[model samples]
Target: MMKRFLILSALISLSIFSSDKIGRLPVYKIAVEAVPATEEGIVLRDFIKEQIQSTSRGTISLPLKESESGNWEFDKEGNPTLETVANIKRYTDTDKLVLISTEDGQAVISFVDVLHRKLEYRNSLPDSLSKTLVSDFLGFLDKKNIYLALSETGSGSNAQLKINSLKPTYVAGEPIRFEIESAEDNYVYVVLVPENQKGEPILLFPNQIQNDNFVRKGDRVTIPDKRISFKASSVPSKDRIRAFASREEWKEFQLRGKKEDSFYRLLPPAVTGTKTTARSMTVVPNTLTASIEQSPVMEWEYQILSR
Candidate 1:
């Protein structure tokens, strides 16, 4: 059996792995994110940034994007979510993502290394922000020196993710119907944010009924488009819809909620995207792959507030 890869982002062409882009390397931008995004988290985020830069003596470049909202929300599983990542991408331009999360004065961090396809360097804050992480980061670059070369190729140059129609507000229990279209064939993933105060983001597409997520271009899609015994969800509890449109297959997402239940939950992505199609509240991939970051993606979101 093959090992499962995380559904972080679309894989760029394998050729970039062939050579380090004509013998060139970039300083590489690293973005630091805090889980929970509290004042302490923000403080820790800043502290770690300063410490790393100072400790590295200069090779590691971690630029705090002014566009960052510093709101690192997580799924119920206490993991950083894809929605958060997509939001970051929508707001900032970063080559690598570093997630720092702490509790009870203890901290842990994960760095997304696309070249190795692995998450690197996890230790406590202030103390662990040592030269080891920087050395490893720089060492990988110096050795493999794989930069995301995305100039000559693009997955869907003609594709666009758009909302065809959606009501600003709907009466509780009313049929939720909306329109979304893409100019080219694409794999569209959608998640629903529930109205509950402690609710997690749920995977709305690739559900039990509508298992096929590949949509043809030029045809407007009515979501929940499964051709079986189903219609729109009338839960009236969900208020937000986040959609991701990309031209490549994501890694794989694992199931969260138990089967034989009313709904299945996909806790989602252990560095891989989900494929089970189970209806579960899950997180999207925060650390995307180089190919995905280099390629075109549509992250469309809308929320209907309760009156």
Candidate 2:
């Protein structure tokens, strides 16, 4: 009887860990409202909707109508009223309600948390409706969520990876240094992804140069050591560094066809099997065959400004 109970407990733990490794994202019901009548308003609304869907990896639900309480109200200028904002904060079912309004050629975006009844994020554009403006807004949203999720998932994990840069920003032609640390003995893989490019992530470790991605438990590893350095991209853009650690060896499966150029691509099966869309330049552990039950992944973002 005791052996059966132990087996059942192990199975339950494996189920929970496997679900997370396979990219089961937390679902959120998001409400969006924008002054769709005007050109700028339409642009803001469409961009927000598309970006939310993409960044959330389709984990968000968009309802066509407002909540039953009907507390969401907008002024004649299409701005959210204080009472409306309060009502959205008071509501519990909705995850967030995004309100976008443009006035005097400037766009304002606000993210309200209905459960917490607090203003999550508020930003005003610099009186322009360019693609860069939209990209910046979307990047802000993606970065915020990505960091928050990573923090929550990484906390209290048996095996974890943390990445830090030598500097806050990098310039063209400069070599960048990264400090990596792991909480447990695991094989660590690091990949550097430049957001401006549409190619495979540059594998920083376990390559021809280093040939070693294994780290001892509670050990600190630095990439591009004193003798070597990672060169910055010529183009200026936001980039990200993802570190995936596992108790077992991980093998990356390459994809064919149009993604042929991407050497580090995850196999099609891994993409289709996962619940969330995989990010470019990051490895999904479920794509790899490992004997272990838990595989944890973490990521950090930085900027590369043009000189």
Candidate 3:
């Protein structure tokens, strides 16, 4: 039996692609998780405030909307907690957040991406702030583009992953085959979203039958390696496909219920951050060089039509 999400080539395709009930991706928002009340924290907060509103100061536009979240909640490790990070997502219209606090008497700042679920670790005030502050502050909204970012790693990864042999289009009842080419070691998952775009997408790989998602680098994995088959849907629709590969083993948060041939249903990523824990990519402040690691995320969209 296949795990779920992935359909067996022999099983006829059905319907299931939808982005969000809103009929489109939702716009993201930003917020200030909290500013420290300590003398250093206050100073840092003032500096940030003066910078972000400079663009609107004398202009006809509105001031930077700032919410002073009461206080900071630290975990046992002394770093900000995930629940605190989630607070911004839960309480505000912002998709991103800037947190200011004093760490060991030094003023530090962290950039939290609520949508992507990452925190750019703290950096010293002197080394981080500058004239471009406002632009950078508001620019968080466009900071990450999944389609483009996942496609280009800024640098080709050691475990380069490729999706190939998929036809640009497919018709109902037709056999569909594709290849997931990658380096010696990497984990991967693929999702199919039907044209209707109404609910969760279908997981296409790592099914019960093919439960092992791990493959060596430079490996070319073919769907339906077995004699059984997978055919296009008898019902016509334009569907989308998303695949993710990384050195780290990862899985999307799935909903609980009856399984379709043991296939799992994934939560919508845009709003609920279903795969937010997985790397969508986060960057630290300047004066910090990023070490090479994590493929971040990957996706592909294909047109499957039925006549």
Candidate 4:
């Protein structure tokens, strides 16, 4: 029986090859089991299941199976050992498994990839677990599987933005200078995402301090432009700067100010087009609007490592 199953699995793998290659793979039957039976564990299990189903988009099917008692066997570090792997394979008749466990008030989610014989993803949960983190994890998985489509196109010949920092790395208290150049008249949006600070995105452009998100074509915008200087955060962390340029003004989202700083209070969720991943910058050929026939949008990202 075991030999027959293995032969069948190999044959199926050879026969299936969908345009979305991941979709062609056999359905991964995953058993989600928690250790010590905690409420958090149960919640996390359900959340993972939902995220997998949502992100897969019928590409990678993860059919859930009832986990038996003592199904989750892992080492002290929350990794499956050889013995545990054998047991899981024997009991589930498959290798993929999600083990959720809490240690020292930190939840650890491990996705064991049996075919690769490695832990695909392992992360310590934050104090407040949000859907963003799940999306990030799912994105990580998609990237690992070479499933993300990072393609961009449109009439962006006149729309271009260049970003440059004074230094590649900076100290906590030092001031960082940025120089931006635009090829055409465009409205720009700049956002800084700090690794140390999760879920708190910093709006650099279009703020009260620098109220000019608009720039003329062939103009260069300099940060700390004689009037203002941008200082580094007190906390030591890595950060990423994303700059977006568009021919048409973005009316879909609104930025609100609180006290001295402005933030994106209501940003519309990005719509996923066919052959494109959500949150990815994809160009739509025809918006069918008067002011915007072909809304050309361009984006650039840069990493900043701070200590």
Candidate 5:
């Protein structure tokens, strides 16, 4: 009888862990309203409601509430606020509200922790009519691909392998997000190379014979179009790994956000001189030979923020 009980407990534990992992946290309560009442505004309000109700399930809890008036204002840091986000539990009663407003070709979303009086995430979207906006937002919480340069010891083999990049698109003032999976058996090293010069790949090894402290187990890597997520346990430190992108350029990244249509979308990076699209890239084989460096993996989904 004890053995059976133990077996059941193990099974339950495994099942819980195996469930669809919700990549985003619930917002608890969300108050949405369109700017400039019109035929379009009413339709938009209903669309936003449906999207919020469906997409933010495991990510955020957006309870429905009614408010008379609200406005968008920022603090000294120029961060926007969502009038009364603190008491979201009682969001329905108070006149104070958390506001999300949309205008001609732009949309601004903000949230405030009214109780703590702190600001959370806020973003602006360009003119788009995509319905799967929430999916894009939720997708942002998922892991992204990042590019890494690795070099071999004596083989003179230099190559770049695409990894994952971070989400929310780092702003110029924001710090680089480089969280790794674990740190027990690995280290991350980074050498910034010149922009115009073609350089060798960075090295990352498993065994700790090399004095490479640049790459720690939990250290993160970012790419132009993706994010490479790693835990301390899975990091490789022996291989010489380096990056060549500028600190300023590193700030730009693909954004994920909720759409008025109720689906999520991937906002591609701003178009520049170079036309880089993840969709055009071909898929790389998963399992590769250790001797030969592996190719970068590409995803063929919605890189566009709108429909």
Candidate 6:
């Protein structure tokens, strides 16, 4: 597993990559389990919303009602009955309906075409899996992978996140190298924001490693090279911070608001390392300091070093 952290709001923004043109039909409704109302549900909803819009090339509206066990009545053989489906279909006046369920480490998506009265697709996703489960089912319409369709859908769908590729040079900075050996190819995002008197603190994925972006007092520079717009200086003695992510121009996976300010926050708690371990490198700025944990690149030392 790649130590997954679901940013529910990220999906709500629907600003990330989406899969369009999976099928000609526009997706209108997505019914999720009642769990979406919880803290965890928020994250799952964002990812799901992003998936629906991207894959279906249509707008998606999530039904507000909580799902009940009887919401999807199965027949004696365990297949959902048409009669039971009719009840579900009455809520959303859309052409399609998606039934979503989640278990220990995976999410099950069932795409039902109400008009056709058939299950268009079904798939089970593993925990910490990189592939988007939402897009997978939508892509099934045209027999395509959501990941592949995301780049192809383009402007036909509004769910695309644009990424610009650029090169960055390390400048006397403490670099965090995160090697999620078992994680998916999802681009990691890193940001350094001025917090306290110690100046800006660095945050990274694979929170296991110690890597921070470095900059001089007067250096008008932003690393990862593409998000200079957000990094531009602020007035009123505002603290200037440098933010970075695995992918620049992340219109696809954007947060609806300041993630830290949301009810559902980004929690980087300590978890036992499984098959994959994350690492990072950080160079300090000026005489500022940082404390690193058990990272191999940091000489296996636990100490707070000043720049």
Candidate 3 regions exceeding 4 Å error are 1-159, 225-229, 251-262, 267-295
Summarize candidate 4's per-residue lDDT along 166-217 as a digit string, tens digits: 4545544455567777777888765554442233344566655667778888
TM-score of decoy 1: 0.38
Rank candidates, lDDT, best first.
Answer: 2, 4, 3, 1, 6, 5
Residue 157 lDDT, candidate 3, scale 0-100: 35
Candidate 6 lDDT over 1-307, as tens digits, reads 0111111001011122322333323224445443324444456656666654553434565564544335565544435686666565665566556565556767666666555455656667774652455434433432212112221222222211122221121112223121211122223333332212122122332132212223223323223233111211211111211222222223222122232321111211111111112220011110010001000110010111222
Off by over 4 Å in 2: 1-22, 26-28, 35-39, 55-58, 63-82, 89-92, 154-214, 217-294, 297-307
Misplaced by over 4 Å in model 6 are 1-42, 54-56, 68-79, 130-132, 141-307
When sorted by TM-score, best at the front, the candidate numbers are 2, 4, 3, 1, 6, 5
Q: What are the per-residue Cα lDDT tens digits for candidate 5 across 98-170?
A: 3455566665544444444444445557537323332333222121112111221112112222223323222
Model 5: weakest 10-residue lDDT segment is: 7-16
Per-candidate TM equals: 0.38, 0.42, 0.40, 0.41, 0.30, 0.32
Question: After best superposition, candidate 6 residue 5: deviation in angstroms?
Answer: 45
- Tens digits of lDDT, candidate 3, 1-307: 2322233122224322222222112223335433645665656565655443332211112223344454445544444566565454454444456676765645456666545455643444442443233234333322232221222222333225566776666666677777887655767766565444323455557654566879787878876455435666555445555555556654333332244353443332322333233222122211010111133334445554556
- Output the better candidate (2/5) by lDDT: 2
In terms of lDDT, the poorest run of 10 residues in model 6 is: 286-295
- lDDT of candidate 4? 0.46
For each candidate in turn, give its C-alpha RMSD to the true structure in angstroms: 14.6, 15.7, 13.9, 15.4, 19.1, 21.0
Say which candidate scores most in lDDT.
2
Query: Candidate 3 vs. truth: CA RMSD?
Result: 13.9
- Count of backbone collisions within predicted model 3: 32
Better of 4 and 6 by lDDT: 4
Cα lDDT over the full model 6: 0.32
